[model samples]
Target: MSETILPELPQELWRAGKLELAHGVQQFLQVMRVASAGLGQYLAEIESRGVKDLYGYGTTISWFADIAGLSMGEARPYVNRAIDLNPTRALDGTEIPPFAPATGAAAAEGAIGAERIKQILEILRQIPAEVSVEDREHAEAKLAGLARDAGPRQVSDLGEQVLGWLDPDGKEPKDPEPAQPRRELTLQRRKDGYWNLKGLLDDEAGARTAAALEAYAKPRPVDEFGQADLRTKAERQGDAWVDLVDLAIACPDQPGTNGYRTLVHVTIGLEELKTGLGTACLDFVGTMTAREARLAACDCLMLPVVLNAAGEPLDVGRLRRFVTPGQRRALNIRDRGCTFPGCHRRPKNCHAHHIHHWADGGPTDLRNLTLLCSFHHRLIHHGDWQVRMAADGLPEFIPPQYLDPLQRTRRNTLI
Candidate 1:
């Protein structure tokens, strides 16, 4: 190869007029196109002579990266261009044609750059293999002519139009294969005492799970204390999953429950059960705070095994702490839905919450119970809201001190 000299820029070019500066930029781009074509040809020569083996590199790209200080990503396009534009010699010494001869010629003369050549190659490659050699050559020549006057983006759009004209119906569609069964679940305990759940489900099971979660994941209403449901979408979905578990445990037809609706057993000391400040064993797998045990025990979703200080089982309370079905039907009919001031839940979604807790000797009758959804039920237990039965045998809510200094009573009329 002969060494080429670069032309010196005029000293006044820095302060040149707008037209002069624009013309200088166009000349620089033309020089860059010629350099790019030379680089591609050199790469082709290096590959033909197996120069990569002398350098102890596996491929031409690795060798180019080390020699030119370019990353593999930057060197790959040059190598690809070389493979498309350079002719090869067969074993018998006959010359084989390059993939894109017209593009190669234009690039060598500084008439087009790598991007334009790449766009032309992409369009030509998309021609169906079933297409004849004559038809493919015709399409390639037409695209290369368009490239001379149009940008890569315009050329790409024109290629799509040409392909549509060539094959109006597009490629033939194949029949879909049968779906395989797929269902998996992983429940692993973490060091922090929380269970990590992961799973995959088939289409039918996924759709059913999504529908179930969405049915219970509706946004919660603002409470009597003027506090809105600020939980995020993921948080609401998690709460919905808990509600679904509760529903499944309460189902009468589920197998392996031994005619008992509860799924697990929670054992706690009598002092802990009363004070709600200690730890309790949960199904021999982990421990939960006594307060959570109390809440779980409230609905009797898990059977509670009360132990005295001596670690012997003791009768904590009546076996029937949960409201009876007959009593629940009466409560549902009376409250209609959640009795929170702005809640809109239906009767089926409501729980029979105790005005006075059953553990505190409150009766499981109509006068001591009102229906509340899961969110409002927790709010009543944890937030600064209050609930009571009025003289008309209906439930009403009272605002917290921060929200209503006067603490006026309110009722939900939306339900």
Candidate 2:
């Protein structure tokens, strides 16, 4: 590659008027679109040169994902587009043409965007296999031309009409054996410590899974303070899945491991466990913040193994912070639900939070304890919000100064 000179950005953008700003936006978008087309060309060349031979990677998609700091799911589309819109060379050094050369030309000129390019390629792929090569080329040309002045939806509508014209009568129906139900699931961990879950389920299993998740995914009703649930549909569904997993784990009939119930172990140094100021290792998965470990330890969700400076387990007395079954029952009766003001989450979905954090020399007794749902628990721990047990023996929240200048104490009235 050679060094290339480019135009400088116009100065004092804040001084630009509305029309100038709009014109600048249009020009920059066209530049970006053309640059993206160039990137696709480079990607195709890399694929042709053999990503494994050049970069020592198993696949082009994984290599790009690593280089760009993106998940494989996010990088696959770019690789797929590059292969479709750029020509490739066969093993024998024979030059093969692009699947959608016309669309590629339009994209290179920045006349169409990613969405229209995708639409045009899909339209070309749907052309009848028996159609003459000349007819297929004509169809691609027409779709690319339609795409220059229209959005993806308009291009797709025209594509449907073109397909109908090519095959006025659809393929003849032939009787075949009834298909068997099939399902496959893939769970992979990403570099960011998050897991990606992708799956395919047959109709019956899909319907049942949808019904179960939907039952728990309903939006929380507006509480007494009129603050409605702000979680998006996808967020609600993700939380619902967590709820289902917890329910399954809580079942007594679940299989055990080595004569003990399947348990998650959190390993933390004594100082980190006491001060909540460092990281802790989680069993099977990865690490979590000491603050998160402290919170989980309060409810005994994960058995905490306190270690000394030499990295040996210490006798930290696990029962000291563990809330007994009777204590939990008493807590359920006392709080009825999350103690955070305006929250309507039930006891079953709440965690036992130590108002004066147990890690800070606070006793694990009723007076120092409160029930908080996961959202509010994180808010209390990570945000400016504060919770304390009032003189009346019930939990009360003190609003942060920014939320209320006077920092008024509020109590949940729904209980």
Q: Which of the numbered candidates is closest to the native, going by highest lDDT?
A: 2
Residue runs of model 2 more than 4 Å from their true location after superposition = 1-181, 218-231, 257-262, 316-320
Relative to the true structure, candidate 1 has a C-alpha RMSD (angstroms) of 8.5
Best candidate, TM-score-wise? 1
Model 1 whole-model lDDT (C-alpha atoms)? 0.78
- Candidate 2, residue 178: CA error in Å? 12
- Over the stretch 1-415, how does candidate 1's per-residue lDDT look in tens digits? 2233344466987688897778777777777877877888888777766664567788888899878899999888889798788775555656668898888877876778888898888877777787887877777777877887888778888899878867777867674775566999999999899889999999899999999999999777665456678889999999899878766755657677532335557788878877777899888778988877766555554567889889998863336566666776787788888888888987666677878776567777898888887777877877888999899988888888888899999999887
User: Candidate 1 clashing pairs?
Assistant: none
Give me the overall lDDT of model 2.
Answer: 0.81
lDDT of each: 0.78, 0.81
Error of 1 at 150 (Å): 17
Screening candidate 2 with a backbone cut-off below 3 angstroms (N, C-alpha, C), the clashing residue pairs are: none
The alpha-carbon lDDT assigned to residue 221 of candidate 2 equals 76
